[model samples]
Target: MSVPAWLARGVFRVQEAAMRRPTFAMLAELERTQWLSRSEMLDYQTGHLNVLLQLALAHSPWHADRLQAAGLADAVRAGAVLPSDLPRLPTMDKRDARDNVERLVWRGVPGGVFPYTTGGSSGEPLIFYFGRARQAADAAGRLRARRWWGVNPGEREVYLWGAPVELNKTDRIKSLRDRLVNQLLLNAFEMSPVRMDDYLQAIRTWNPRAIYGYASSLALLAAHAEARGIRPRLDALRVVSSTGEPLFPHQRELIERVFGVPVSVEYGARDAGLMALQAPDGSLLQMSETHLVEVLDAAGNPAEEGEAVITSLVSAAQPFIRYRTGDVVRRSGRADPGGRGLAVLDAVVGRQTDFIVAADGRIMHALAVIYVLRAIPGVGQFKLIQHAVDRLEVQVVPDARWNDAAREAILHGLRARLGATLVVDLNLLDTIAPEASGKHRYVVSHVPLHGALAQAVA
Candidate 1:
């Protein structure tokens, strides 16, 4: 059973204190900063940028060299770096973060650094470290965004997320922690027919004020509920927040129709941090206090729409200044209708990963298989193609860590998810080629979901 909102809030605060995270403190600051005017917002971002650059200069030798080569080393040291000076430095990519992590990371940052992995739907598995400041910023930013939709912290939020893994002890502990914080985690990784039915019932019983999850995963669950003639009584649900992938128009319509609440899109990357989130006014607003997002074309020139390169102000544990996110986004060039000074994003053309169908007819999120590859060390840039129900192929650009054990781990992990009868073809390559369309996708599946499930998604 879910705890009362007041009790949840108290429990959350106590836990945050124990973890030494300034979550609520940061949230309080963000709550006030959200009202800054456009120029004022820029000033806020610039001040934070200066601090981050100084941190990188002092602790991160790799970034220090880059700053010096960009001719801004002295300026950064003097705490006089401006927003315009950002362009002087070259952009860093996922490979740079992976290969030069030791040089990029600041192990001595206050509050400590913790390692995290994300294969992101982009198929690039990245292992990055973040400190409590970043952790607090992400949490606070989401809290600020949720307030825009009339949903406050500790108000019974349901996460159709991927946290509940196959491991038993870890799963139980996570489940318990989620409850104390007044959050429910329905496994987005499993999502079989039976499990989805239980999810529908759980959401109804919990009566959460907000539902947050992957866009496609939420759509799939909504479709399942509709097919089974289950219209959940979710009067308390203020918004259904979609993240992980782009919320296509059709998916939005379906989710809104099924949930009886408006659907909101949340755009962010695991490596780049949270960039923007949709407000009640329907504009995607950047986290002005924590992130500075740039839309640059393929040639690296500023554009109305192109790739998103972010400078995370709070990421002092590992500075990500001018880091290329590989996400295609268009700048709105419009002011916030809600009267906030936050910058807007017109659209985010996020990469889509197709669903994988197990041999036993279980529908799994692409992350299900992606996790198999991400957990195994030595696998570099990789791609997974599901050619049929029982057949799958994984192409990997192996790094120095690739070995006999890593190869065996790949086979064992994939089989564990796709079923033991699965036929796995593992291809090790020096480079992963883009698709025939000159676009790169990390996961592709030729097999389609049959019957009502297919129709709901279609």
Candidate 2:
């Protein structure tokens, strides 16, 4: 190992030793539970679910009233809450989370509360709270998934994702900490051809064991690499994991062919935490230890094809009890091929948000603009149209929450992303129609990507 690698490992060991016992124990426990039988796994999930529900009742009056109203309170009080019996509770949507955030938070939670905002895929910004367990659930579950791909924690890995452009002092410190963990963060938002080449070279030098990025962004990079006849020979590379957007079949083929590594899919949301990961055996296994995934039809009936109603077992600090995720998923009839006993899903059916371009020629993930609009309260539903590098049109469907200040906030946000000179026109709409595909994407970029190479060279 290099000197820096040795130093990173040393720092990691010290940090691990300083971690709370409960947090460390949880990570250790997942290693064993992943191999349990299906029935045993279900029981294990229910055990955590029951504990979360009790915590919700004790801390969050909003969830407490719902459980009592739905007649699920008695069963929970009697300690008879079963994994199979969760559907008796009412389902929650983003609106409930947005409006009742305070009521839903368990402030006195162990390790305290953490506030976070979702970069909305459905154009609905939701601010939610989480605690230590939720954070550990995401990180440790991902570590377990990496092990499935023959990679371990502290192993060299590359993150191809959007980064905060303006980093404060705290952000810089976090970046240093990230480097100490043997991880590199590449800017996924700006992927001009020249930068892609630089990124490929960086990968060759770093020799990351695994590559993780947005599905579309990785595919775009692979396409660019193929176009330029650049096939990087990274011997240490093991897996290429795609996330934040659905992995289209063609995109998957392109990525696999270019990277010379197996491609895996990760399905998760900031609010929901890590839900599922594509196992090495090709099964999309729900992280059943941390979440309870339910596919419910429009009528709230259990169905093979429907929206994913998630009950996050780790989200006790802000219990997302039977929350409707607005994500389309089809439950798989196939069993776990790896026989790890985790729940399986056939596919995640969702449209990939298009990449956006800034006035300064930064190619950002669609979530960058989505993050701006969704974080604003008066924005009931929004659609961002990037007409040019320096111009944007935002179509917002305001509910009863509409206000004039939202317009200025929207303009300020657009300028921040596209540039100060960018023209932003906000149009208030009563409704925004879905595409011919019947899916409503929060962001659409009409600005062509043909000039990416030229922009990069400039």
Compute the lDDT of residue 213 as modeled in candidate 1: 92
Q: State the lDDT at 92 in candidate 1.
A: 92
Each model's lDDT comes to: 0.87, 0.81
Q: How many residue pairs clash in each candidate?
A: 0, 1
Question: For residues 1-458, could you state the per-residue lDDT of candidate 1 as single tens digits?
Answer: 98888888888999998999999999999889989998888888888899999999999899999998989988987889888889999999888888899998999999999988888545678899999998998888998899999998889999888742433446667778889899887778888899899999999999999999988899999899888998889889999999988888988888898899999899888888888999988999998898888889989999998989999998888888899888889898799998988888899985776788888878888888887888778988899999998999999988888899998899988998888988989998888888875667888888998666775555
Cα miss at 84, model 2 (Å)? 2.3
Task: Using TM-score, give the best candidate's number.
Answer: 1
* TM-score of every candidate: 0.97, 0.92
Against the true structure, candidate 2 reaches a TM-score of 0.92
